[model samples]
Target: MSLSVEEVRRRVAADWNGIVDVLDEKIALRSVSAEGIAGENMERSARFVADTLRKVGVDARVEQATGADGKPGAWEVIGEKIVDPDAPTVLLYAHHDVQPVPDPAEWNTDPFVGTVVGDRLFGRGSCDDGAGIAIHYGALEALGDDLGVNVKVFIEGEEEMGSPSFIPFIEAHRGEFKADVIVVADSGNWAPDIPSLTTSLRGNATCDVHVRVLGHAVHSGQYGGPILDANTVAAMLISSMYDREGNLAVPGLEGCEPIGGLERDVDELGLRADTGVVDSYELAGTGSLASRLWTKPSMTVIGFDATPVKDSFNVIAPECTFRLSVRVSPVQAPHAALEAIQVFCEEHAPFGAEVKVTMLEEGMGWAMDPDCAATKDAETAMAEAFGTAPVNMGQGGSIPFIPELQRIFPDAEVLVTGPEDPQSNAHSPNESVSVSGLEKDVVAEALLLDKLAHKPEPTNL
Candidate 1:
């Protein structure tokens, strides 16, 4: 029985209101995984996902996965419906956890409320992973129990906090998570109108470096230029990470060239970032700005501790601390890149200052070779749903869990996609997702599942 794309699209359209209702429930839960935040929301969010799945006819369960520290981590929702033992299995993956709302006052709507205005739904997690859940749910509902392929739903709860327990969780449940294909709904597209298949993702690592120049604070008038200030030493260490052109100077962490010539309009990118590059200043790194962002490793000082300027008395600070946020190329191992960073800091410590570097967390990057039958079918499904050809793009951000999934399911074909556009502003104030985009992805995923059911089982290549 050939399933027409129009039929699936119609089913998705009919289920639009129900999908949004589910999304609203997900957004309402403040499922943040940051330190000091209540774990109730994360637990509730996972339960909500399992309940949503079970309500829709899939047998679901909420299980807790321990973090790297061997303590209780986020709740994981795993659901499965075996329609036919002989049929292919496809796993739908997403995260229920969300980033913390930096400031609720800065948002036009409450960050926890799913507010709809125009064609967009605004809330924390609205676009990032909330849309992922809704997409999977809507698609599964449209297909009902006879979804052609056997289906499994896995929604993680601590992705925003680096998925520290993901590997352990997968290892403990290896047999239950096997699949022919894994559709990860946690990436964004090139535009609202254009669908994109993310083919590469940058790796991520973080470290805290503390520099101390003196045992105690000294008066600036008495010490002055003779004394080496910790702030000056910290600045020197940071500066050494970049060369004259502001490219990462750390050795042994090489970057890969872009596989596809992906380019973005600087103006559109600037609009998305909410900041514009000055005409006088040259863009950093080598190659096109697209490659620099998507393929090259980049370093940023995400946090710094120093004396407040407002409370300034002329004083030479005793110490300074910096949180280094590093993005490595998809081709580079995160551990290798982290080692390079540590060595660079130690070698460049200025004025005999005491420098201590500590590794916080690291996640490997991934590059998907989209030559498989499953991925091709997904590309076609997305094209039909979006009314345009799908583009293969690279995402600069890290979905740390993806690499782990790939490692555990080595033979399974993986496709990364989401309903977010640049304007979604995920992880920022006023985060949102397009209503139309969600609908399109729902139809796309449903169609892909339908197509997979009819195709030959993927070979274990």
Candidate 2:
């Protein structure tokens, strides 16, 4: 039976109030990553979500998983059985983990205490991901027993730490967690009031570059001019990564196919305002905003450690180290990218200085094949919800678990969408969500489930 749009909207409206209460209670507790709350508090957060699932007639369990470092890394709460066991299942993914609250003085309210001002919910995890959890629960509750397809909810506690333990956990229980579709709710819409499906994510690789120009530090006044300064050499090497046009000059970096149908004028204005770049400064070498940000590989010098800027600076620094982060194309191999970066740093070092490069972390990117049946269903549902076809977008940031999820379920259609907007302020102070945005997302998710449950599976790409 087809559910009436009005019926679904009503269900979502009723559930939205309850979801806000649940989110408030969950956010009131401090679940800062690996800190603030450990042991019992960590268990408490897991239990809270699990129990909520159970109360809504879903079979839920909390499972412990060991980390790569051999620590009790994370716990996952699984909610199961939205439809017949043998039917195709969809995996709904979200994270309960959150970053630590910075200085209390920086926040408008206690970071752990949920506060509501106007339509916005204020809290540390309010927009980053706690809202994601709430949305999943709301969609499931709104659908209730009427849901036609099987759905499984997997909420993890280690997403804030790059989800190191999740891949292992998924590997260990692949049989029990098989799915036809994976709905990753951890991402946001490209802009407010616009629904977007993230089709590509840029892979990430981090490395530290160390340059030693001399055997020992010397007085700058004595050895300044003729001596090779390690800091200057490091600066030169870093600057070489980008050309005068701010285009990445790394060899073998591939560009993405441009996405049409986007308002280029609006995107450029938004990018400039968001990035705070000077109006006169041309926005880099770009074919399209989506192509430059999503398809093209980029490099950033995240941090540099050397002699302190304070105190006496008369001495010539003997050594300098810089932390570099590279965003690779979805098709690019992270290890290969790391090797290329290492070679570049070694070959480009100035003045024949000794340069050592060490990789810190590497992860592959993920891209969804938009030709899949689930993709069509999701797009249809989103169009129904928002009155227009959803934009196929790409994310510049990497979600650590996406590639792993793809590897674990190669045949499954993965879809990434959520209530988050560009102005959501995720992972920063004063993060918030629009009530209407949440409403639209809940409706979209419910409609997606309905559409997926009834649609015929695609026979060919």
Candidate 3:
């Protein structure tokens, strides 16, 4: 029997309570990366998801993928069944991995323990993505007896580490997981009550700058002034990458143009808050927030490791290194950006210090065609479910698998939306998801599946 919207809502509401129970159980297992609860915990979470999918009658399997470091630490749990092999398939994606919970004392409750306070469920990964995964499972369960479309769900375990194994896995299993549409539910809405469809993700490239000035550490009393401090040289070169106006000074980096339909005030405030800087600190660059965030190129000094500050006697350090993370425009090539940053740093080194810049990792950005029919259908479904229009947005953070998926499914439509709201506090202490948001997401996913399943074939671009 086909379920009405109200019936679906009711069914989801009933199922969500049980889903939360499962989420609590999952959270209690502590799936933190590279810690005490790393691989085993993630595997258990995957098994739980696989078992849940099986209970809903989907043929589920766990596929292990090697990490970038050639470690066998990552895996993807896929649950799929092609009811009609001739029908177009939709691929649903989410990650099962989570960031390590540092300092559980900072949390109101144990970081590994899911706590319900008022209308929200709080824990690590609860809103960052676990909520989305739970809702995906809930939606499928709601449609149990009346499954209408062929769907494949892929939950990865290394998204926290930039989805290192996703591309290789997708390439290796291309034919087995073919889909007409890919729905990524890892992003959040624009605001607490508003619905948003993420259409763009900024690319990420990381490079390290090492400045070696002295052959060895020398006493501050002996070589304080003339010895050429490696830390000072590194700091100067690293700081030079940004102009006095707070704009990136890296050469060959291209800027992006703002897309229409996004508001400036909202973007400005949101950017300030997101960067953890006060509104009084005027951000460099002119134009819309989207332009500055998505289209614009940004360079950041992520960290610096050298001599310890606690040491009593200062010395001319032999070497110092600063890690830089650059965000490129969706259209810019990562290798090109990496090279530009390296060349600029080397050329701009201070006082003839020996400088070395090395590319650590690179991932391309993605820009989805918003005018596509799948995007439109997703908008329609979201609007129907939330009783509001869905806004098109861009994420400054990079999801490494996004560009890969775009390349793999060149002709397919991709939509990124989820149950996360701005207040979810994902990847932070007190991470949580609203009960209302979870329910709305289930409704949105169910409606989206219904709409996409009935929609006409998309024309090739």
Candidate 1 wrongly placed segments (more than 4 Å): 29-41, 67-72, 210-228, 259-273, 276-282, 310-319, 349-356, 456-461
Angstrom error at residue 415, model 2: 0.6
Weakest lDDT window of 10 consecutive positions for candidate 1: 263-272
Candidate 2 has which clashing residue pairs, if any?
none
Q: Compared with the true structure, what per-residue lDDT tens digits does model 3 show for residues 1-461?
A: 33567877877877877778767876776766555223677788788778877877778888777655777767578878677776668888888778887778888877888888888888988886787788778878777766667889888877887665778878888876678888889998866566888867888999888899878888888868877788878878867877777778788887666443463334566656766897577777666667777668887888988767786356778898889898888878888999998898788889888889889989898887867888888888777777788776777778878888988889878888877777787888888888776778778888777766675557999
Per model, how many backbone clashes are there?
0, 0, 1
TM-score of each candidate? 0.88, 0.92, 0.88
lDDT (Cα, tens digit) per residue for candidate 1, span 310-382: 9978889989999998888999998899888888788778877888899988888998876788878988999
RMSD after CA superposition, every candidate? 3.4, 2.7, 3.5
Please list all clashing residue pairs in model 1, or write none if there are none. Answer: none
lDDT of 2 by residue, 118-189 (tens): 767788788778888887888888888788889888988878877778888888888767899999988877
- The regions of model 2 sitting more than 4 angstroms off are 36-38, 219-223, 258-266, 278-282, 457-461
Best by TM-score: 2
